[model samples]
Target: MRGKAAVVTGAAFGIGRATARLFAAEGAQLVLTDVDRDGLEVLREELAKTGAEIRTVVGDVSVAEDAREMIAAAVEDFGRIDTLVANAGIIPLQTVLETTPEDWDKVMAVDGRGMFLTCKYAIEEMLRSDGGGSIVCLSSISGLAGQSGQAAYGPAKFVATGLTKHLAVEWAARGIRINAVAPGTIRTERVRQLADEPGGPEYLEAIEKLHPMARLGEPEEVAAAILFLASDDASFITGAVLPVDGGYLAQ
Candidate 1:
């Protein structure tokens, strides 16, 4: 990945941060973005010590203007974007009956529409480069199967999967590849917060047992999969939803 340029959104923490660090180690010039400005700064400093070329953008993915600027920054700094990881998202736990219209719209805007906009602009910039690029969207297991309380999040992610396939077909002849990664229960701060709540630990333990692996996944584990899809190794792969779910989706 030396001399390659990549952009990772929601890169302040969790899978996004893990992917940014891994990409940097592989010699890719990176542009990391997130709405969490403080976290982004801390992450920038931590990774900068590695002597990797890095840039940071503090903005929300739900806004089209911000998405455009992020892509523009990558091009302005690195001359072209080689890969894009549209990983910014929110997972609000709410049942169908409990979810409000506003919540549904918010989740869709960030998880579904945000991905569309990112791919839209990234493709535009990538077409201008010497060669085309790859794009990976962060989807979830809920997008594949029904979950107890993922009314809004699940449907929105399902749309992300669909978007990935659509773009892959529409742009394949143009040399751009698009795909998605559906992650299972990963051990992140968000998951930890749920587990710390009343009965949340027991609930999580039961869920863990349901997976054949009998363990929750790590953010870096998923990051590894995303990295592969973003690299030349996956040149032949497109419009595919690769599951990193510890066999949860298999069952």
Candidate 2:
């Protein structure tokens, strides 16, 4: 990733944060974004200390203008967008009967529409530039398989999964690679919060056992997979939904 320019959405937390740090360490100039301004600033400062060229856009990825600006930042600040990690999302663990119309729309806005707008703009920019880029979308194990409590999130991720394949095929001849990583339950900040809820520990324990590995994955672990898909290491790979699950999908 040396000298490459990358954009990471949802960059203030979890897998996004880890990816930004890793990308910086690997010598990529970054445009990190998230709705969390304070968190984005803190990450920017941390990466700056390492001399990583960092710019930040604090906005919602679901908004078209904000999505465009993220891609614009890459081109404006670093000449071109070499990669994009479309990792911005919201998880709503609810049953179909329990999920309201509003709840479903909210999840779709970020996880589905957000993914679409980011990739749309990024691909447009890539087409305009001399070089084409790679895109890594954040799918989930719920996206790959049916799950009990992900009524809203599961379908949204299916958008991530489907979009990856469609775009990969659509743009492959044009030199832009698109793929997705469908992760099992990862121990991200959101999941940690769930662990503190009433009956949360028991709920998590039961969930953990469902994975063949009998454990939850770390954010860094998922980030590593994202890095591979975003980098030239995955040159021959496109339209593939790689699982970062702890053997959950295998089962």
Candidate 3:
């Protein structure tokens, strides 16, 4: 992806941050965005040390206008869009019966609609460019199956994976390739903090047992898959949801 232009949403921390760092290290010009302005600046400064060509957009992916401006900034800075990592999402851990309508909307807005808006604008730009670009979306293992406390989050990710398939087929002739990564429980800072709460360690232990590997995954592990899907290394891959799970979905 040397000299290529890439955009990553929810890039202030966790998997998004790792992806941004890896892409920059690989020589891609980057447009990193997040709702966390401070985190965005922190990451920007960190990347500065590498002398990478990067720009920061502190905006919410759930907003349509923000998504447009993000893609616009990438094109204005780097000439064309080559890669998109729609990694913006919020995981709400609530059972269906306990989840309120407002919660459903919140999860849909950030996790589902956010991906749509990003792809809508990015695809528009990709079609207008010389050759279409690659798009990698984040889907959770909860999306592939079902999880007790992920009623809202799981359904939204299911939509994400569906959107990936529908668009990949619709835009294939237009030269755009789209795919997704289904991650198991990743050991992000947020998850770790949550695990420290009362009864949290036991709850985490239960989750670990569910995975054959008896461990949670790392943000960088999933980021590696994101990078692959965004690169020409996955030239013939599209509409596929590659699992970055540590055998969680296998059994």
lDDT values for all models? 0.92, 0.94, 0.92
Candidate 1 residue spans exceeding 4 A from truth: none
Q: What is the lDDT of residue 216 in candidate 3?
A: 93
Could you give candidate 2's per-residue lDDT for residues 26-124 as a string of tens digits?
999999999999999999998899999999999998999999999999999999999999999999789999999999999999999999999999999
Task: Highest lDDT: give the candidate number.
Answer: 2
lDDT of 1 by residue, 1-251 (tens): 78988999999989999999999999999999999999999999999999989999988888999999888888999999989999999988889999999999999999988898888999999888849899999988988898888999999989988998999999999899999999998987798898778878887998899788999999999999999999999999999999999999998
Measured against the true structure, the TM-scores of the candidates, in listed sequence, are 0.98, 0.99, 0.98
Worst 10 residues of 3 by lDDT: 194-203
Q: What is the lDDT of candidate 3?
A: 0.92
lDDT of 3 by residue, 16-66 (tens): 999999999999999999999999999999999999999999898889999
Q: What's model 2's TM-score?
A: 0.99
Q: Sorted by TM-score, highest first, which candidate order results?
A: 2, 3, 1
Clashes of each: 0, 0, 0
* TM-score for candidate 1: 0.98
